[model samples]
Target: MTQERVAMIRERLQQALPVQHLDVEDESHLHVGHAGAKDGGGHFRVLVVSDAFDGLAPLKRHRLVYDAMGDAMRRDTIHALSIRALTPAEYERETA
Candidate 1:
């Protein structure tokens, strides 16, 4: 189920943003037996590098991702998401 949710989120972003680099990690295991996981919500982290976010602010980037998740958030499919939204250049620079 966690993998499915991650796949859905990744697919949505790829289709909509065409990211240069995308990484989705299911951190749910780290939260096992925790409150969030117990409620059917999982902890995940995402790293997305795409020109689509070139000029967006950090908050806007998060908003875009949350928007894409839509009902997933409401349904407790995703409880917490840590996102690093970046352009290709930003991602490369950070990794350097």
Candidate 2:
């Protein structure tokens, strides 16, 4: 179940963005007793690097990710999502 969500998220992001790098992690175990977990929703963190986010504000970047996530967010398959959406240049600077 955990891995399935990760795969689904990664695939969805990849399809929506021209990602240079992507990492999706399941953090559900850390929030095992959290309220959302009871609803079968999972907590996740995603690092998305793409030129698509260039020049966009952080809020907009997140919006794009949420939009890409689509029904997953609305349907409660993803209860919480921590996103680090960045352009390729931002990624380079962060790694540097």
TM-score of each: 0.89, 0.96
lDDT of each: 0.86, 0.93
- lDDT, candidate 2, 2-22, per-residue tens: 888899999999999999999
Which candidate's TM-score is highest?
A: 2
| Candidate 2 Cα misplacement greater than 4 A, ranges | none
C-alpha RMSD of each candidate structure in angstroms = 1.3, 0.8
Against the true structure, candidate 2 reaches a TM-score of 0.96
Cα RMSD of predicted structure 2: 0.8
Q: Please report how far candidate 1 places residue 70 from its true position, in Å.
A: 1.3
